[model samples]
Target chain A: MKKLSFAALAGLLATPSAAFAQEAGGIDQAVNEVFAAVTGPFVNLIFAPLPGTSFPWIVLWLVVAASIFTLYFGFIQFRAFKHAIQLVKGDYSDPKDAGEVSHFQALATALSGTVGLGNIAGVAVAVGIGGPGATFWMILAGLLGMASKFTECTLGVKYRNEYPDGTVSGGPMYYISKGFIERKVPGGKIMAILFSIFCILGALGGGNMFQANQAHAQISGILGDYPGWITGVIFAGVVFAVIVGGIKSIARVTEKVVPFMGVLYVVAALVIIAANYQQIGWAFGQIFEGAFTGLGIAGGFVGALIQGFKRAAFSNEAGVGSAAIAHSAVRTKEPITEGFVSLLEPFIDTVVICTMTALVITISGQLMVDPATGNYLMDGNMIQTVGGTSGVALTSAAFASAFSWFPYVLAIAVVLFAFSTMISWSYYGLKAWTYLFGESKRAELTFKVVFCVFVVIGAAASLGPVIDFSDAAIFAMAVVNIAALYVLMPIVKKELNSYLSRLKSGEIKRFKG
Target chain B: MTTSIVVGLDGDGSGMRALDFAKKLAKGMGTCELILVYVIEWSPYSFQTAEENAVRHKRREEEIEAALERVVTPSVAALKKEGFSARGIVRHGDVADLLNTVAVEEGADQIVVARSSEGGFVKRVFGTATANLVMHATVPVTVVG
Candidate 1:
């Protein structure tokens, strides 16, 4: 779920650029066309809809895996929700513990990685295309996604490689390989390699490109028409400064600033929702009505479901396994604790934050609803907008209608979100790169340079094929990761049960009352 | 009866003054035990990047070791050499809270801290450890300025 905001932005950006590509002439344009042509077959295969259905099979694959995990874990997301909060609150964290950071810090860092543009622009994309009904499916997907996160993160900690120097590394790559070998499953090594390759690509595609692309979009949207490559070059330079220059000051500033931005965005959305208190019920009615009946919208309820689930999955990334890498660094004796901590991620990212964006968009009176049929007026296939905008711009318009200065604030937030996501993903990609090659200074530098270069390419190019390939690369990770989870779930169940029994017997101590 | 007193240290002149004041009070009381403690200010809620978080545990351990060697150990040896019952502990957390916790856990008779002279906007807003300990500690708090 590499900020579905960028993926959706790319999707929307692709439409206008596709219409104008012939009129535009440049090396970058030519490169984008060729890249799209070469990767189109692969992207289509990964995202291809099921037979006789408009839904993408990859979406179905993720939804089904999450559903199965929810059932298999006895809906542990719900059952252990309170326990998860307690863990995050430091109730179970001993000050004398051996881990690097507290559960709260780990949760915060992981939250930073997941809760970005996905909640902002991605929600806009879902509600725009899928209608208000997409909000409902998005909430359901988030609920089910908690279980998928639980399973993968537990295995991540269990199979992590703890170094002698007290550093550790783990993710789908480690667990898939080691868990498979332990269970006597063949092709574990090959599967791990495959997952690593996909992860590196994902880190480049969704993590780097999509972020750079959308950051440029949001900036240009505010600053008037300008070449995207210029924005791309500036962004790439800053990113290179952070990742390559090893500038601790930049990380520290962003570490403080990004969370503030997240809060600012949420507060802005809440204020908008509160101002339109009367339309609250009407908007919800549209969400519920559009969810089941589709309200004369295209593809009916199915369209809403696909858009909702896709956006939710892409936003929170429960089954995606990239989060497992981040969660694995948490210090805990029981791996199940990290798993429990992880379930809160989708809830915070999708259920709470994304819903705020959906409500703001729905209540802002941007999407024209017909007074007679009570259906949304459609422009071509999209919900017709009063501002005649789409993607992140539509969201900005909705918020700006309320605050009048939200676009400026949102632009800053989007850039910060993109930079933070890029930095986090760079670490994730570097881990995969080192796993494939050996861990060395040269290897790390090589990945960083290439990653920054892609950031430029991502911003410079039109988003058509870049978005497609990014979506495919990220989903490809889930394809390998979920398959590994299906096999290794019993181990998690055993861990969960043992931990519960110990808690019941008073063996698992709580540091705080 | 031997009384126990917890003295908070900041590894500076103020800390040594606090130690001196505690020693004088302990000597006056006869056969007192001095528990010297130094806390490296930290909060679990502070935001950190993945790379920062990954190294935090090691950094914390290093911090504790450095505090023990550079501050607590020397203070303990000096006190003990002067015929005082002194032991040192180094930890990572908010100074006031940790001092109170240590005092409560040790069943100390009183807490002693040096009033920090570095007063500024941040310190004034957040409040100094001496002010907080004086207000919140269950045991008696003596601020030696």
Candidate 2:
């Protein structure tokens, strides 16, 4: 599985820049073409249905699915909130434990992985295309997503293994196979192998290439004719230095970078909001108004609940097994302790950051428009199509509108966000790779070498539909991943109950400082 | 050539635990000075304008020092009793940066800090500070659990 992800990432990055050139007039014009081709079809699909039809089936189904997970767990995410606080508090500190890193570092590392261009660029796309209404459902989806994260991270911890040397390894592949293994169920190992394949593909397509490509686009556009291929090569090298060091170093770096980037991005959004403070009332009105009323036609609403749910799922990654791959490495013995802290991820990524971006774009009121195509823009007056879940450029334009330096600041932010994400996901893919191949030092180094090559490839390539198909392999991971979570939800329940009982019994008290 | 391997220590008064660990290494080697680091967490008390309140607020450090005397000073006295040369010194502000600077200044062989408890004000201090030392420090760190 890990090998395939690396292969796909390398393939995406290897595509010739001549393919990207298109003899195009400017970098924006070329990159924008890719954006239109990807997002256009989705916008048409969402708006195509006849008027007065009830919300799309996806909307109903997602809401129901999210609600079931939320209620069945009795909002375990909320109850675990205090435990999450204490998890960092050292109520359960075990430095002698088997893991490669500590609980807090693992959480920060996972955040650095998931909270990327999605929060900055993707949120703007959601509001730009889906309209303000999408924000409503985005929050709703995020609310339920907390439940999804809780379920997956718990499974990740339960199924984790410690090598004789104290290195820790666990994720969906292990949980799916091992959970059923204990039950003496057949096909569990086969299922585990399939999930590993999906994970490796996801990490390469989404975690590495997709990130590198976006980072390339942002930097190259800002710099202009600065030899983009060289820029890409440098990015891969920087990523390599961190990747070769393994999880402890990656964790060490992200624990500092994630909070710095997240807070910085939020502060930028606040500046935009303050610049257009008077228009805030109308922005809120448009959001609630567009969410229900459809902006596609005179009457059609833009995002509806379905678009909101889909985009939110893409943003926070609650159900996906990726974050679980990270939380599993934490040092504590109580799986639930990490699980509690893990829940905070979705809130920060989606509910907080997404909301900030949505408010910023909505307030600016310029309306997203595709200049040449007129596809994403409405009557050429507003956006005809929102960039397919990548809105960094549009958000950049909005920030630049308010402050002269914002575009450059945002460009740097995007690159740093992308860099942190690529390194962390490399760890995730390596674990899955180890599951398929034996865990020899040689095998690990091979994966890292191949992974580094892909970083360069993703940056230089055109990032066409071929890469998009591979990207689907990443999202497709959730289908197999959530299934594994289901069979293993019982173990998750036992762990949570056990941890809670300990907390209440005072067995897990604050270290007598 | 003698390598000046300084045994470095730093924390709040609670850092006595680190001092104990530092003492062991200094005694074992018999060739280094023991530097006890005290990072006085800045508070409103530090700014108390009245002499009494100022003293009371300043007392937090003194109180911490008194506690340190119980934990760290005795080690210094015991080392002197054993006829080995050692000294305990203090510095303040941003525990991680302070530790790093002292490590370089002392040309320390190793740094010893207590494994932070998972709760309270100490969490932020030790968690980030230790992480900083890991990334930026010149010497090896032995975090006593």
DockQ of each: 0.53, 0.04
Q: How far out, in Å, is residue B17 in model 2?
A: 19
Candidate of highest DockQ: 1
Question: What is the Å distance of residue A414 in model 1 from its true position?
Answer: 0.9
- Give, for candidate 1 chain A, the lowest lDDT window spanning 10 residues: A4-13
Write one digit per residue (lDDT tens) for candidate 1, span B1-145: 7889999999899999999999999999998999999988888888777767666666777888899999999999999999999999887788888899999999899999998866889787988778888888888899987
lDDT of 2: 0.66
lDDT of 2 by residue, A244-313 (tens): 6533454445446657767887988898898788988877776676677754522245444655776778
Question: Candidate 1, what DockQ?
Answer: 0.53
- Candidate 1 is scored at a TM of 0.93
Q: Evaluate all candidate structures by whole-model CA lDDT and list the values in order.
A: 0.86, 0.66
Residue A254's lDDT within candidate 1 is 89
Q: What is model 1's native contact fraction?
A: 0.55
Please report the interface RMSD of model 1 to 1 decimal: 2.1
- Per-residue CA lDDT of candidate 2, range B1-145, in tens? 2233333344354366666676677667756666655553332112111111212323445655764676457766776787656666554345666676677877777788776545777666656566666777777887776
